[model samples]
Target: MAELWKSLPSWVRNIVVPVLVLVLAWNIVTFVFGVVGALLAMLVKLLVVVGIAAAVVILVKKAAKS
Candidate 1:
């Protein structure tokens, strides 16, 4: 595999890599973002819930410490 890749010309590799990356990125932008965006939104909501929980914990801790 390494020898096969090494046999290819540098220009070929350069062109192929950029094209593949562009296609993969375009698909992700067009398709994967929907699922990933939903997951990210859920993550943000979870973080908010965690933040509120932490604040309550901190207030309780401070009250006890005082």
Candidate 2:
């Protein structure tokens, strides 16, 4: 592997390889951010559902007291 890299032209070794590495890193970061965003969205939706359920229970109890 080292021999093959050493044989490559200077422009490819310096520019192309670095650009490819950067692209790979960028793609990985984007994928991680997408996963996190989806998880957060699900959490927000779950909280909203729980809040609605609690509100309904409270209202029912208040009505019973009246």
Candidate 3:
């Protein structure tokens, strides 16, 4: 597993993981917000902004590590 990781270029091993993680995290945030937003607010539109911000933060942090 470690060897396989090493075989890839740095951008793939580093940037790609963070990007995939960010996408997955963003999806999860959206799903959770959808369920709660419907119950809590008249509009669920605000959640998209928050989710994008959270996903960007996650991506930035992960990218910084690399």
Candidate 4:
């Protein structure tokens, strides 16, 4: 491995390697953001359902008291 690396030109070693690393890092970050966005969307859906349920319960209770 060391011998192979040493055989490569200096420009390739410096430029190509860093560009590959940056691309890989960007892909990883994009995947993480996608997962977080999905989770947040699910949470918002749950909150909306809970809010609607609470409103129905309150209305029912008020009607019963009347």
Q: Write the per-residue lDDT of candidate 2 for residues 6-60, one digit (tens) a residue.
A: 9999999999999999999999999999999999999999999999999999999
* Per-residue alpha-carbon lDDT of candidate 1 for residues 1-66, written as tens digits (9 for 90 to 100): 999989999987889878999999999887877988899999999999999999999999999999
> Which stretches of model 3 miss by more than 4 angstroms?
39-66
lDDT of 2 at 3: 100
What is candidate 3's local distance difference test score?
0.89
Candidate with top TM-score is 2
Model 4 has how many clashing residue pairs?
A: 0
Cα-based lDDT at residue 36, candidate 3: 89
Q: Estimate each model's TM-score.
A: 0.49, 0.84, 0.48, 0.78
User: Which residue segments of model 2 deviate by more than 4 Å?
Assistant: none
Instruction: Name the candidate, 2 or 4, with the larger TM-score value.
Output: 2
Assess candidate 4 and give its TM-score to the true structure. 0.78
lDDT of 4 by residue, 1-66 (tens): 999999999998999999999999999999999999999999999999999999999999999999
Which wins on TM-score, candidate 1 or candidate 4? 4
Number of clashing pairs per prediction, in order: 0, 0, 0, 0
Candidate 1's displacement at residue 30, Å, is 4.7
